[model samples]
Target: MLILTHTLYLNRPEGEIPIAIRIYRPEPKDGCWACTFEIDWPEGTKTMSGAGLDALQALVISLQMIGIQIYTSTYHHDGALRAYDNEEGYGFPIARNVRDLLVGADKIYL
Candidate 1:
């Protein structure tokens, strides 16, 4: 069982929403992880399942269903933080310190 918490700003009228996500891996079959997820959102609860290389990938897809995008970047020399805004001139610091870069891919949920 892998658990993650994320605060997301939705485009809907309700605005920011806090969600609790849980991923469960029953057993590996044929060298693949069979993952299922349970999302506890403000509105209600939802569950889903899919096949992924790992649990993280499965979580990414579950979040995408609610309009969240998760990904990584290799453009920077140190391979900038995952989900950092890649758009030109967005006001994010170009040279981020270890603390900021170490935030991890989960920070995108914020």
Candidate 2:
């Protein structure tokens, strides 16, 4: 089991909210592995279960719950960038590179 806590900042209400994510795999039954997660936030909490969900998927679900959207695009067929946008029409500048984008993303999603 892995547990992580993060703080998400919102522009709509202009405040910070705490979020907790937990990921674990239950004992295999009939030789299949499944991933389960729980998300805790200021407003409410949610739990999900699935098969073969990776770390990125888990983070995406948590971010979606808090109303943040992530977009990725490739430029000129040479490089890639990511954008972080919220429901209130607020967006972060396009990241210079994937590494830079992941660094910013880790703060909110990890």
| lDDT (Cα, tens digit) per residue for candidate 2, span 3-109 | 44333332234543344555554434344444555656345666665443454444444443322222232221222222234222112223334423434445454
Candidate 1 whole-model C-alpha lDDT, 0 to 1: 0.41
Which residue pairs clash within candidate 2?
Answer: none
lDDT of each: 0.41, 0.39
lDDT of 1 at 70: 17
Model 1: residues with Cα > 4 Å off, grouped in runs: 9-17, 29-32, 53-110
Question: Highest lDDT, which number?
Answer: 1
Pairs of colliding residues, candidate 1: none
